[model samples]
Target chain A: MLRLILKDILIQKKTLLTAFIYGFFAIYVFGVKYYTNGGFVAGAVAIGYLFITYAVSYDDKNNCHIALNSLPVKRIEVVLAKYLSVVLFGCIGIFTMIIDGFLAELFGFAMPKNYVAINNVLMVFGVLLVMYSIYYPLYFRFGAVKMNIVNVFLFMTIIVLPKALGEFILNHENNPLIKEVLNFIRNSPKSVIQILSFAAVALISLISIGTSTRIYKSKDF
Target chain B: MSNILEIRNLRKQYDKFSLKDISFSLERGYIMGFIGPNGAGKSTTIKLIMNLIKRDSGEIKVFGLDNIKNEKEIKEKIGFVYDENYFYEHLSILEMKRIIAPFYKHWDDGTFKKYIKDFNLPPSRKIKDLSKGMKMKFSLALALSHRAELIIMDEPTSGLDPVFRIEMLEILQSLIQDERVSVFFSTHITTDLEKIADYITFINDGSIVFSRPKDDILESFALIKGGKELLDKDTRKEFLAIKENSFGFEALTDNTDRIKKIFKNEVIIERPTLEDIMVYTVRGEIKCLDSY
Candidate 1:
């Protein structure tokens, strides 16, 4: 399983440099001008997303699944490796953000303050895990070429859904249900919310791994 | 245990094609040439053996264990080469090897280096930059680097020049001489098989036409030439397929001795090549209809 994850990294080693460049640019733009908290989180999430997509695209472009399946590794191992790679890429993304911050400070460029908080890192991981939980099973079933349109649609939805939901909440601030939900979130213990969020994301990731494995097991190459 | 690979009543179905209970076995230390025309389920059957695809029914056994139950164990002992280069194209040969070597239990770096030197493959070159023949050699080098007991190749020589094709056959010929490694080679190139294959398993339109010793098949199947009148409805039963022209008729018969007895000295009986058997068998019905 480690070998599989390492394989993904090795294949995308060239892209790692581009990820660093993109990370610095995102930090400077989003950190200095726009949303302050979102800069590092957005940079890390984008880097992680880029790594996973590049790894999967290379495999699909080369039809390497046949070679992978022909090896002594189990299909479940392959699926688990992909899931684990999200964590690896997440780490790389975090490291990229920190390095970008250091370079920004060294070069005397303006950047956001306290961008790498524990909450922000946790949020980055949570968002990535949930997004990939939705992407992988579809990728395992339909493959990269067939899933291209679905991927674009999914990216669009992700971009649009948050703003749309925020607008809906703002417009309904006077509603009793909205006020009750807001009160519950405000009154909830921080640790409890953290535990519950972890549990929910972990559950989604586990289910995604299971679905992807089942789909990949019977797949014809 | 004597058979290195075995498929019994194996079946798969697609919208346009299906394999109908195909069965074949390759004993240890022998190269079984799997021959068929294009889209004859040769690659599909190979994929089924490798468990690359799911089979609807029947069992596949490798090294005397159920393929699915022992896939990991079985794959460890099996090395495979496909018609196309499936390795990551952007990665260097050395980098790809780094990824694949850990997957095999008995991967020998020395053996891989030997193949690299012998095949003249530059390890630093990216896979996409290599020519088609070079890519195949790299695949073979990888397949052979591990201490694999069974090597399954699906059309490993399909698109190569004749020189490279012969070289590929020569490599297989030498690999099996150790008497421990067995090879299952699938190809539409019958001539290559005739030169190196010990056993021949022929598949046509997802069905096994025959699986037997190469010499036994060659000796038994005959090509007969005679007058068109000699090919009556009753006499036609002896031939698997027949073709007629202005000179007269030419037919293929598996029962060569019986054909000799029936035709006596009136017809000339000639030995049939593997290509003759495949071409005649696959085109037989259509050719018969065309002649009528």
Candidate 2:
């Protein structure tokens, strides 16, 4: 099963290279701009989330499921391998962003300190967990083709809703509950929030993995 | 004798077609030709046996083990080749073998190397770069290398040229020398099966039309040709399909002895070929009126 997973990764080496190069540069540019514009933490997390999502999309685009099934491995192994690969890629993406943040800091850019950078990593993990929760079931149920369409629709919603709501709440500045929660989160220690965020992401990832495994085991192909 | 594979009353229903109580058994070391037309439930039945699809109701036992309950153990001993190439486009033949070799406990590297050399497949060549025939040969080589007891192939010879088809059939014939291996090969090309199949199972309209030994199917069934005068209402009833013209009539029947006796003096009784049997049986015509 490890060999199978490695084979899948090796087969897409070219795509991986392209995603890595493009993601590194894109995140670097976003990081630099956000640091200059006073939103470095949010910007890094958002760009990291996008990069990981795109990386996961490569497997869906390639119909790796059918290729994996054709081998002698069990269906459960295939599902678990995919989830593990996603998590592996997520860690790599997060590590890349950390390196990007250090590079930006070295370049005399004004940005959040080390703890905020760590919090940004935690936020990226949370976003990836949410993305997996939404996409994994879609993939197992409808396959890659239909999931692509669904992913696009879901991506739009994820991007637009948070920004729209954030704008509305900030513009009104009159919703006491929203203000209180935001104030609480802002005042919470960075370490505590990071731990809670990582815990939430880990819980979601496990649930998604279980859901995908069950759906995949029952799949016809 | 232990049966290598046994399926009883297997049924699967789709929106357009359904396999109605299909059942057959293949003993160890015997080649079973699963002959069927398009949409005839041949692949469906094979999928059910492989546990690739869920069966509506039936028992599938492979190597004395229940198919669903022992799917992984059964799959370890079985090698399957789909109609289309299953390897990833980017994967070279060697890379594919490298990935697959670990899954089977009995994978023989020497045998795999031998097959690659025998098939003349370039180990470094990507699967997408190979021709259709080369791809099929690669798949066959992979299947044989795993020391599989039962190799299930779906239309493995459909698109190959006559030479390659013959070569492929010969290779399959040689693989069963151990007398411990069996093959269930599905193909519409009857000639492939005619040359090698120990037992033949004919499926039509999503059902098993006939299943028997190759010799029995050929010997018991025949094509009777004669003028319309030979084809009285009584003799015509025995034929599965009949074609009549102004000068003569040709009919197909399952019971060659009975039909020959009925029209012994008038009609000519000739041995039926597998192709003829398939065509006439599928057309669902038994009597011909002498009009044209």
Error of 1 at B259 (Å): 2.4
Q: Fnat for model 1?
A: 0.93
Listed for every candidate in order, the interface RMSD values in angstroms are 0.7, 2.8
Could you report the DockQ of all the candidates, in the order they appear?
0.89, 0.40
Candidate 2 residue lDDT tens string, B1-292: 9999998998888898899998889999989999877878888888788777778898999999998887778888888877876566677898778877887889999998998998899999998899988988888888888889999999998889999899988887887887999999899999888889999999987789888999999988888888887777776677788878999988888787787677676778888889888888777622233332
Q: Which residue window of length 10 is worst by lDDT in model 1 chain A?
A: A151-160
Model 2's alpha-carbon lDDT is 0.75
The alpha-carbon lDDT assigned to residue B112 of candidate 1 equals: 96
In candidate 1, what are the lDDT values of residues B1-292, reduced to their tens digit?
4888889999999999999999989888999999988999998998999888999999999999999999999999898999999999999999999999998889999999999998899999999999998999999999998899999998988789999898888888898898889999898889999978899999988899899999999998999999987988799888998888988999999888898899899999999899999999989855655763
Candidate 2: regions farther than 4 A off: A36-67, A95-118, A153-169, A183-199, B285-292
Q: Model 2 has how many clashing residue pairs?
A: 2
